[model samples]
Target: MADRKEQDALIQQPDAEAEAEPEPEPEQLTGCGASALCDPRRKPHRFLVLMLMCSLSFGSYFCYDIPAALQTQIKQDMKVNSAQFMQLYAWYSWPNVILCFIGGFLIDRIFGIRLGTIIFSCFVVVGQVLFSFGALLNKYWLMEAARFVFGIGGESLAVAQNTYAVLWFKGRELNLVFGLQLSMARLGSTVNMNIMGPVYDAVERYIGVESYYCLGITFFIGGVTCLFSLACGLILGYLDKRAERILHRKSHGTEKVIKLSDVRYFPLSLWMIVMVCVFYYVAVFPFIGLGKVFFEEKFDFSPTHASAVNSIVYILSAPLSPFFGLIVDLVGKNLMWVLLAVSTTLGSHCLLAFTFWNPWIAMVIMGCSYSMLACSLWPLVAFVVEPHQLGTAYGCMQSIQNLGLAVVSLGSGAILDMSGYFMLELFFCACLCVALIFALLLYLINLFQGGKLNLSTRERRKLEDQSRS
Candidate 1:
């Protein structure tokens, strides 16, 4: 009887142990799944996400440059001088000084990337509509207010865009990804510069030339682009959510709350980069903002010709940025690329300011260099900062950049009005020289810090492997 009881106990123990053992998790998909196109980790899906992310900012970029695109009509119809015309850009930059930083924080803290993108996109649509209405009613104040609101969305959306780029592409294809994004953004701007003038002219036939209503109608067309961007935002959110669920991605954000104190720990090299952003971009953007008129007045070009020339920078950037980005990725030496970009840009400005060459030559050179700078410069932030702190870091850089843009937009307008385009170009050259100086400082700092920022993709990967080993 004792032997029989022991046998039963042993059988029961085996049954209990089997029940307690956990089942194996189902095999997770890491590569092209059954449907490769639908697999989030696959290249096709990543390309889709990249396209959506890049298109996400298309509307804002298009609308933001509307004033530049139709500068002649906006100023003439609205009865504003060069200074007040620049107020359009100044108002756009003003609120972004603080709001963009908050936007980045919110992306990190409260709202994740998907939700943040949608909300900012909505702001763009609403602001554009209000801007159109203001033009219809011929209220300059309302137009400025609309631009202020538009800016709030526009710049924040950019921060979110940058965050998304780093989130998915961080090590793989990061440079080309950024380059593609710049390409799409410049495409939007180029489309605006080329089409807005024709759009205004077409609208003018019905509403009459120099009518604010005509400007209003032309701007309303831009709202359609915003709507398209908003839709992309929605689809991207859904895809991102689906990917997160399937892939169990834990890199979105950390469980630990981000603190302002984190800023203190950021390296000094990042601050120098920030200053470089401020100085370099202040020269470029403000010039583009007021470029149409400068081209018309200086080069003796017709309105159509001036618009074409003014858009050349964006035209070159649209197709070339991605290529330049690929080169930067393969070659590395991002600081050297940055230095080359600034020097070339300075030379271009000198040509425009001092020489009487075909404006196209100078514009083409500026365009290519601008593309190189964008691909090389923006990615530096991702290198110096941790993933979790990317939002804050990018936000700070853009905020300070907006501040510089705001001050300089106003200053450039004043200089243009009082001094002339030649002087305005000189002002730009000076800003670039200062930027070059800072770029040099950054090179020295990076050199002493082991030159990680300047390493090619292969070298970086090898170094990372060595560290891990």
Candidate 2:
């Protein structure tokens, strides 16, 4: 025991030396990011900013799912097929493949987050407006084009959102905060899914369901959600700017100017992060895009019932994620949680594909897995990279994720056209298996090369300081 103590002391000696050296301190805001350096009794209005961040994408989330919920009606009314309906997601994701990364670069290098948020929010508004009008006019290509525009904004806005999360809550309960944000977003999706059909039925009662105008008007009502998000984005921008000026968030000599060269410097862990994100999402979201139809066909559900059943994933996620995030924060095994989440998700897909279980049970299980993964997954990125690079890293990841969404989304729809929904589920299983492999690989990598990622923010930062020295 004495020898063990000596060995421990020897191990901590270098850490002691590193602590003596000055390092770039992590962000610390007293009184909730206001200038309350003297008063440390309470947190600042950071939670208020968190609320803004949560609502920042509410509109996008609301509108994004409407198409999915209204998929059957759209195909029937427009005489479109599954593949053509899926093209909406493809159009939204394809432009973001490059643009999201560029927007992130601009945020890191030139535009800064405030400008990026507003610019992206504007694109969201205009694209949604265009989409609404295109639907009204029954111009399918126009709707696709508008979705493309919305994609551009959506991806960048996501990067901005991640940037804000790290900026305010980096060393705090970041996982909890991210989970809460996702909960808010998922709530929007859930609400959109549930409301769209009922609202459409009501609107059709008044306006008559014969024309594309009704579809367009129904979508336009959802598009208004984005306008509300845009307002919150503006408010967030003003508040962020004020905080930056007042809080002096960025430390001198710690400012990093992002360049094309730095892109090459991202570590292997980051690539794995990208890989996992791409594969996991290609499995998850594209499935959601087509889920309503799947439930209707395979489960023998009515259209309204099918939409509600499919939305069960989002519905449960809205309330469950914050607790899952808190669990992640407390347990400090984010990677393990992520792995389990994916594994369970894979199980849910399998149950749907193979078993005769009630689809609602499978969906609720999937929903819990979704929330669990949501809390554990994104917060891992903040650990892998520095604050300055968070935007670029998230951007790059979003871009890659978009690529997956675009290609797999189209392919999934095409497979549904050629093979059927069961085959599509198999494909999702395949993608998620790949994601699971990446997660396992990440755990092994971190285990062998210093397991900083699973540590709390304070512990991780301290270890980072020691390693830098």
Candidate 3:
């Protein structure tokens, strides 16, 4: 121990000397036109700008899910059946899945986040106006069209948020920021579930009739919120411009080319990870869409009571995500956590499948399963992908996941109609089983391959040492 301490002291000696060395001449330091006395301790104003951007992005993206939560109310008001109501959810997801990759490319190459945010905000605004009209006039086709267009906008914003977070927050509390952003969005979903019911009730009472007035108001508010988000984007663009100028002057205007080949494996691993994400969401999100109605019908509860119970999942999920992220960062082994989370999720589904139970008890168990999966699974993408490719990888994953959700939503609706019961729960349980099998296969592959993917040599050494000890 003494020798090891001496060796550590010796290793740090050179760095101490370097700090003690004489300062360079003023001309040598000042040639780049940057201040030598810039205080690293002072916080950058850019962080504040980025936070606002993230908040706005969260608000806009969440509007996509809000409509789905209010589906039954919308259907009853519009006099449409469950099949037609389900199509609205499909419209919201389908365009996003189809155009997600393209959104990523545009964000990385042509538009960057500034133009992308603005362009996408327009789509959201236009879609909201059309949706508001449909709600007021009881035009189902128009509502579906609005949902499709809104999805394009929301998908672009989703990609932009992930990309922007990677660019602006890398190596500086990135895990915390990612978790916080996600939690905020889930908070939006929580709010939608809990508050929308009361709001809809009030709106229906106020409109002098029982109608889909709340849906119209919700879309209108979303449109206005999007405009606010666009303004935040403009501010972020300005700050980015200022930061770029400072960096250029400091680096003597030399352009740095980051080689994409160095990160090729990142994208490859991300593709497999996205497949995992798709299966996970396929097993989960449709249940979220149908949760309230299913619980109400299965257990004979009021709509408000059902929604409140379902809201527990989102509420519990929001706060737990950050802790899960901290665990991943601290442990530095994502695969084990992924396996554990998926295993627990599978068990939860199996329990739900095999038994008939009270709605509250079932929701609690489902919420726990979803919380584990939601928090643990997403951070794995950051582990597998390069920092530069985060946007593309996240976008690709979102696209695939959205596709699965879209298909499952439509199929589950048809199945529910045909089977004469809410069969989505069983179908989703089967999907979870498949996901568990895939997770096991991925684990075995990593085990045989010496845990090379995502794990650095140092990390592997630590794991091996821990095992031996």
Task: Report the Cα lDDT for residue 124, model 1.
Answer: 95
- Against the hidden true structure, what lDDT does model 3 obtain? 0.64
- Residue-by-residue lDDT tens digits, candidate 1, 1-469: 2111211222112234434655343337654453677677678899899999999889999999999998888788899999999999999999989988888888877787788899999999999999999999999999999999999999999999998888778767678889999999999999999999888888988667558988888999878999999999999888877776565443222234567788889899999899888999999989998988788888899988998998999999988999998998888888889999999999999999999899999999999999999999999998897666677788888898999999999999999899989899999999999999999999999889886988877888788677645
Top candidate on TM-score is: 1
User: What is the per-residue lDDT of model 3 for residues 370-448, given as tens digits with 9 covering 90 to 100?
Assistant: 6555545666665565444555667777888789878888898788778844366678777877777777776666667
Global fold similarity of model 1 (TM-score): 0.92
Error of 1 at 190 (Å): 0.3
Q: What local lDDT does model 3 show for residue 106?
A: 62
Q: Which pairs of residues collide in model 1?
A: none
RMSD over all Cα atoms, model 3? 8.3
TM accuracy, model 3: 0.81
lDDT values of the candidates? 0.86, 0.82, 0.64
